[model samples]
Target: MQRDQGVPQPRLLHIEADYSPAVSKTEPWVDLRSIRIDEYLQARSLAVKTQKAYRQDLQHFLRWTDKAWSAVTARQIAQFKTHLVRKEEGQRVLSDATVKRILGTMKAFYGWLWRCGYVDRDPTIEVQLPKLAEPEADNLSDEQVEKILAAVAGTKLCDRNLALFAVLQHGIRAEAATLLNVGDFDGQRLWVRQDKGGSKGVVPLDEEGVQKIQAYLGWRMSQGEVLLPESPLFVSASRRNRGARIGYDTIDKLVCQLRDITGIDFHAHQFRHTYATNLVLDGMNPYHVMTLTRHKSVQSFRRYTKAADQQAAEAAFYETKRRKRKTEPGSEQ
Candidate 1:
């Protein structure tokens, strides 16, 4: 297969000492896998975490194959699927969903190789992967959101923590939130310079979220923290990583802290789910919700709608009972 004309070729990155296209394909296949994976990844604008995940998944496939690339066929792909699901003593039995993801990675890998003219046939093409169940978005109610906000309202680092929560509440992922810069906030909105799924744009902040972020920046200035365009929006206050760009670990730790204090069984991602759910419940257009959530695919946006539909059905049932009780004989109008 000749390289597609419109496909934007990505610059080579992370080349290893042992990686050379000139190296014979008959050698250990790791070199070939790494080179091809790098090329495959660089061709598209995937998130850092996404790219890393692809690398890991593809590497696992390469190791499992344990043979020359050209020799793999649909039968080997099926065998690999069995290897993932078997409950043998040493074999790590994966859930159907996980196995499905791995198989997806395999299809994507071979598909790319075929498109890039690295492979003649895609062994994963005919092999079937399990159909996944509809994903349910977590429900973090409005009251819970208020409780989370109020929990930090009196703290000394109130501005800082509130700013972080504001960003999360507005639907920014923890990793992307951590990657924000001081100048990313424009008083009215946040510029999500980097986003998952290659969908980067400005995420409009609610008035309260904007105020919290502005106050946080103001508080930093009061503490003699020099604010610069390039400064990390959130800095670590921990002794080890103090004044450095906040890490995703810190985001997790903060959620853990809040979970302990408020007795809320939630994690960082629940905020995003809540954000999307709230939008859906409020009758926002799906396209508008997708824009707000920065979802590039309708499939991704549909998860919240599924949960919202269930919630609406339950709400209507309760509402019907309430109306019937109100109109009962001798009941108050």
Candidate 2:
């Protein structure tokens, strides 16, 4: 009998392969841990939440298929997708959008595996993504925004709250707000470095905004804390002992705090919506508003432009007509 090098004995092979001809001596199975998902995601510079989501989705894909990931075929992937869409006990059927997200995770995993020499080719290249329904944007009323700002004004957390409000009022995203530094501001313009879609732009700062920031900076200087060029514009007082930078969580907490104080059920993104809605209501071109907000798609911004409330619209219409009548000759003053 001829012996195969680096191969298990016949008894071991039979048990390992489950006596299937497809699992031959020529092909070896690779385990999931060999892929190092964390390292791969880090190398790609994926966001923290993205890394977590991809790992979870890939784990689900692997657990569904008992075989090693490298041994999974395109047919098996299609079947797994079918399983996701079919409702069964202990198996929650995912929506089309969710299935697409899982497929994307699988594609990225396979692509990374191939690039790392763990696999020869990606099997998920042909997988299709599902179309997602556009969600309506969440916005707050002008009164609600004013209430939140006013609440911030009367708090000990004034500086941080002011910065957060500024970002919302200006329609900037959290990522852009987090990147802001002391040096990004000239006397007149705020230079947003690599904002949404990696585009740099300048937003003019109103006199009041400038004065508020100056006052905050002055207060910091009086306390013997000078903001360097590299210092974040909004630093957490709690983090002073930790030597860590102020993160998005701090900003989120401040927003929540303001909401609690003002009795407004609003999140940080609602601020951006309020800003965009106000601009559109004031007769600013949607395109110009888009430039200010740096929205990648016009459709994304359109969701923020709420249909004018019927009562408000009627009031404005009657008010305009009344003004016109009064302005005419021989009309009531």
**Which candidate achieves the best TM-score against the true structure?**
1
lDDT of each: 0.85, 0.73
lDDT of 1: 0.85
lDDT of 2 by residue, 62-136 (tens): 678667656778888888777767877766578787888888888878887888887776778776777787666
Write model 1 residue lDDT over 44-102, tens digit each, in one string: 88988999988877776777866666678889999988887888677667888888888
Top candidate when judged by lDDT against the true structure:
1
C-alpha RMSD of candidate 1: 15.3
TM-scores of the candidates in the order shown: 0.80, 0.69
Q: After TM-score superposition, what is the CA distance of residue 212 in candidate 1 from its true location, in Å?
A: 0.8
Q: What is the lDDT of residue 133 in candidate 2?
A: 79
Q: Return the lDDT, model 1, position 193.
A: 86
Residue 56 of model 1, lDDT score: 79
